[model samples]
Target: MPPKQNPDAPAAPDASDALDAPPTTKTPPEVIEFWQETKQTPEELAFYAPEYLCLTILAVILFFPLGLVAAYFSYKTMQDNKQSSWEAAYVNSGRTGWLNVFAILIGLGIIYYALLFS
Candidate 1:
C-alpha cells in the first residue's frame, strides 16, 4: 500500500526546478564593457574586410611582406580610432600576419637545408 500524500503541505522541490530559475547576480561591469567594445556594427565589420583579405591572400601569395603592410595599416587604423571595436580585429590581423612571416621564413630555411644536403 502507498503512503497518503499531504494535501495542505507544499510539494518537495524537484532537481529540474533549479535549472529553470534565472541567474540571481547581475553581470559585472567589466564583462559588459568588454562585450560592448568587441561587438561591431556592420560598417565597422566592413571596414575590416579589406585588411582581412590582404592578410589572408597576400601572406600566402606575396611571401608575407604585403601581408605585414596590411597588418600595419589595420593596427594604425585601430590606434587612430581609439577604443573602437575594430581594435581586436586589427590586433589579431597583425599577429597572424607576423606569424605567417615567421612561418614562411622557417619553411624556406627548412627547404634550403633539405635541398643543400640532398
Candidate 2:
C-alpha cells in the first residue's frame, strides 16, 4: 500500500536521484620527502700536504738506499700537492715517513753489528 502525502508538503527526495549522481573521483595521496644537504666552503676544503724532506735526507745519510727511497717519496708528495692530487700526496707522505724510520733503524743496526763484531 502507498503512503498518503500531504498536498501542501514538498515532494520527497528520490533515492534513485542520489545513485544517479556522478561519484566523487578517488585521488592518490600526496607524497612528501625530506633530505639533508651539506655544503663546503673553500677554506673548509683546504688541506695540508706533508713533506719530510729534511728527515728523509737525514735518513739518507744513515742508510743511503732507504733514505733515497724516502726522499723520492717526499718529492712525489710535493709533486702531487702541486698537481692538486690530495690523496696521492697523502699516500706519498706516509711512505716517506715510514721509509725514513726504516732507514734510520737500518743505520743503527749496521753500527750495532760493527760494534758487536769488533
**lDDT: which candidate is best?**
2
Residue pairs with clashing backbones, model 2: none
TM-score, cand. 2: 0.59
CA shift of 111, model 1, Å: 0.6
User: Tens digits of per-residue lDDT for model 2 on 75-110?
Assistant: 998777666678999999999999999999999999
* Worst 10 contiguous positions by lDDT, candidate 2: 31-40
Q: How far is 78's C-alpha from truth in model 2 (Å)?
A: 0.7
RMSD per model, one decimal: 12.3, 24.0
Q: Report clashes for each candidate as comma-separated counts.
A: 0, 0
lDDT string for model 1 (24-92, tens) is 348587755644665543344456622444444545554556445545655565553444546565665
Cα deviation of 73, candidate 2, in Å: 0.6
